[model samples]
Target chain A: MAKNGNDKSRHIIQFIWTLITNAYLIGFIRGKIYQGKIKNICVPGLNCYSCPGAAASCPIGALQAVIGSYEYKFSFYIAGFFIIIGTLMGRFVCGYLCPFGLFQDILNKIPLKIKINTFRFDRALRYLKYIVLIVFVVIMPLLITDIIGQGFPWFCKIICPAGTLEGGLPLVILNDSLKSAVGLLYGWKCFILILLIVFSVIIYRPFCKYVCPLGAIYSLFNPISVFKYQIDKDKCVECKKCASVCKMGCNPTVNPNSLECIRCGKCKSVCPKDAIECVSFNKRKTN
Target chain B: MKNNKSRIITVSMLLIGVLFLSAGILRGENIIIFEKAINICLECIGIG
Candidate 1:
């Protein structure tokens, strides 16, 4: 699996966009969040709404908030917004736009060569994210609520390493009051985040593959999203070179459009036969 | 036959997505999202 020639500059766009979306690093200097109109609209990633550097709302947290609000039901607006993102881009957002995914990519780049690529193990674990999406994100919030019609956002409060990383660490470290008040739950989330950070270095995008409710949701639209990662079977020589470069361990030759694929195009970049390419919407690609 | 059926289904799904987006705009989802986002979510960050 020779590296792609463009790999040198391939991630620059992701890097730049990651920084730009999180560009409110100025707030970190002042120890206050950006309170503005832009925070109302959702950004299509796992960025924490509480991150002082954040300019927009997190879709997952917003979804949970709407559900746990006095309404205690699905927000047609949130559902509709997500459906639009899902149909338009699918996990391409995970591939290119998500700060959390970029964080995983950066951690994986930290010279730790441990790879967890046993076929069945990887495939089996992908289902866990779907379970998280259904049970933690959807079911629990709707089913359980306090007297005031507020329910805990189970995934964001308990499981989201993104929140623990982007929002929790920053808020606690910056604010003396918050730091002094850290409790068992904070410690617990810190433990989960540390474990995830370590695993992200060893295993590619373990959270996205195994636990992210957003990833689970986006995956449902991958097969039908406007953007497509297509393989021309006519040109594919069955060399399986594409899988070698795939962080998600997909055989892009056989399953270029697999649900687990983030559509990162690392495989497309590495394809020796020029077999793989991303075909956009509005045209039928027979791959 | 298969491709046509798939196209029809995907088109319908996309149309529904459009409807959802419209509903979001009409219902002022931005206001709801803004309120949740502007506040420092103590519980979300694992605080009480």
Candidate 2:
């Protein structure tokens, strides 16, 4: 009973953070972006800084913007923020903070049966996010410049569904003059966002699992982060229940902090001995 | 040795993160962070 209760509360916490991060509700209604000093800081999740409702900027997008512009030096602030958060908590941001992850969780809760990905295929696709992190967010932004020495923010322009959903869709819908600005690129991004939404309904966080460069970066810190998944071997009964409940397909008994493990704590309740936990300095963290 | 190595790396990362985080505020130009933050960046809005 306590386990189910804890899960409910965890869901509530994640939902609350989602609301907090996207809390500029009036931004959507007014169709204007939030322009405040708070916008300078990067939120730890995949929330788009340009989202009409966003109270803060995105680190990855900020990094790309710095890299693409000839006027500014490379971003220490953006990179540092990511590294700081990544080293402290790893992908806990994905589990508890990401609005898109919440979106996926809500979609997965629909009546249709969920699809579990095959291990081989899942492993193969996991590398794609890293490639995207390097190619779109890093290389393309720095290398491909126009006459003014400004390169494109490839990921935001070409692939990031978050930007399209949070920033583009609402702005275009609300503003009349912006409609004339719409072109083929907007159509391409809309198509991509639609596909990702459809997949989220069937698959467990397809974007976080296979396409999010931010997740790719954070996963690097999972093994080294102060807050981490710790297994108490003495308490283990060797039951596979933890693995069974994992939507991201991580085997908790083997590697609890797998790259794809969003640290959602679904596996913790399934552990009969309470062998699995996310802990720091020997103290368990309440999600 | 492995544990020591990871601790070393962790400490190093923390130090660097602190440096980088502060660098923007102290030594860097505002154009880098604000240019993106202040504007309704076209790319971020899914526009070309």
Q: Against the true structure, what is each candidate's TM-score?
A: 0.93, 0.93
Q: Model 1: per-residue lDDT, tens digit, A1-287?
A: 34644544546767887777778888787767788889878888888888889888889998988887775376777788778888888888888889899888888878855767555677787898988898888888787888987877888888888888888898998999999989999999999999998998888888899998898888888888878877777888988778876778778777767888888877877778898877765355453
Give the candidate number with the greatest DockQ: 1
Error of 2 at A210 (Å): 0.5
Q: What DockQ do the predictions score, one after another?
A: 0.64, 0.57
Instruction: Write down the lDDT of every candidate, Cα atoms only.
Output: 0.81, 0.82
In terms of lDDT, the poorest run of 10 residues in model 1 chain A is: A1-10
Q: With candidate 1 superimposed using the best TM-score fit, by how many Å does residue A104's alpha carbon deviate from the native? A: 0.7
